[model samples]
Target: MEEGKPGAVAKVIRRNPKSGQREFGDLVWGLLPYKTERPTTAVRPIHARAETVQELPMFADAFRSRRAIVPATEYYVRTETDGRAQRYVVTRADGKPMAWAGLWESFVWPGDRVERSYCVITVEANATIAPYHDRMPLILKPEDWPVWLGEAPGDPAILLRMVDPDVIRCEPVAQRRGNR
Candidate 1:
């Protein structure tokens, strides 16, 4: 994780579209060549703050090429309470599936082998999420999905404006206190 990345990790796993894998969704956690020395867990940074995307080498080229969409039922973020850290789950106020703007990369290691992985792109929080955390995932709206998913060449400025305060809803959860 970098200085601006958020908590929780995500990976774009491969799903065999023709068989049982298709029933489970198109993702299966896999190892990456970019692991930070420790090989115990593959839980790498899932959310990278959008503001810092330019600084992340993995995202620099990936963002322009293999940009992806993470369809999440709900995503978790963290905050602080009484000097203790807490987590928060951000779901659609309408209770619909929402997609997080993400970038996927292929990490190949030595030994004539290869490992691949993916990460979600986050952005500065809107009014709905700022109180809970300084940043939130760059969620694209239904109408914007085409542009976000590369159907259109998106304007960075316009895309940045998508994180407006009006479109989101936030709630505080009691279970969040246990995350720390």
Candidate 2:
């Protein structure tokens, strides 16, 4: 399975509302709200800010109900370094896969075809990533996965807390294959 990039599909885990069982599936990286007038990615967002995710019209509902987790081994980012562009790879220092917090939605196309899409959440960069970018993917710890996934009784306010910087590590890599 390939890691998700903007406009690409990625593996996801979401709690099934009816059965309360976790379901594993693939969802496109960009979110297309369920009742959008027409299908298009021009305005679809691949990332939602942690501060506004629950208040933003495009993502509020999904954040309240359709929470999901996108697992990945690495997160790549392109940023300027010494007046030149550089690629940085971010991963867990503990050697665990990242559980990225996200929201998923099902949009219906003209012919009534339903398409699933998701957007990763972002937060102010922690110490580990602050040098690379001002913002970074919101990674959830195992203990918080239940709340983020709506699988247990917990307040959504928990999301306001950012991931601990100690678990993350960043390395600048030569711009090469698989930059995305």
Per-residue lDDT tens digits for candidate 2, residues 123-179, read 999988888789988888888888888778898757755688889888777533454
Predict model 2's lDDT versus the native: 0.84
Number of clashing pairs, model 2?
0
C-alpha lDDT of residue 23 in model 2: 91
Instruction: Give candidate 2 regions above 4 Å deviation.
Output: 1-3, 174-180
Q: Candidate 1: which stretches are off by over 4 Å?
A: 1-44, 83-87, 109-114, 175-180
Predicted candidate 2, C-alpha RMSD: 2.8
Weakest 10 consecutive residues of candidate 2 by summed lDDT: 171-180
Worst 10 residues of 1 by lDDT: 22-31
Q: In candidate 2, which residue pairs clash?
A: none
Q: Per-residue lDDT for 80 in model 1?
A: 73
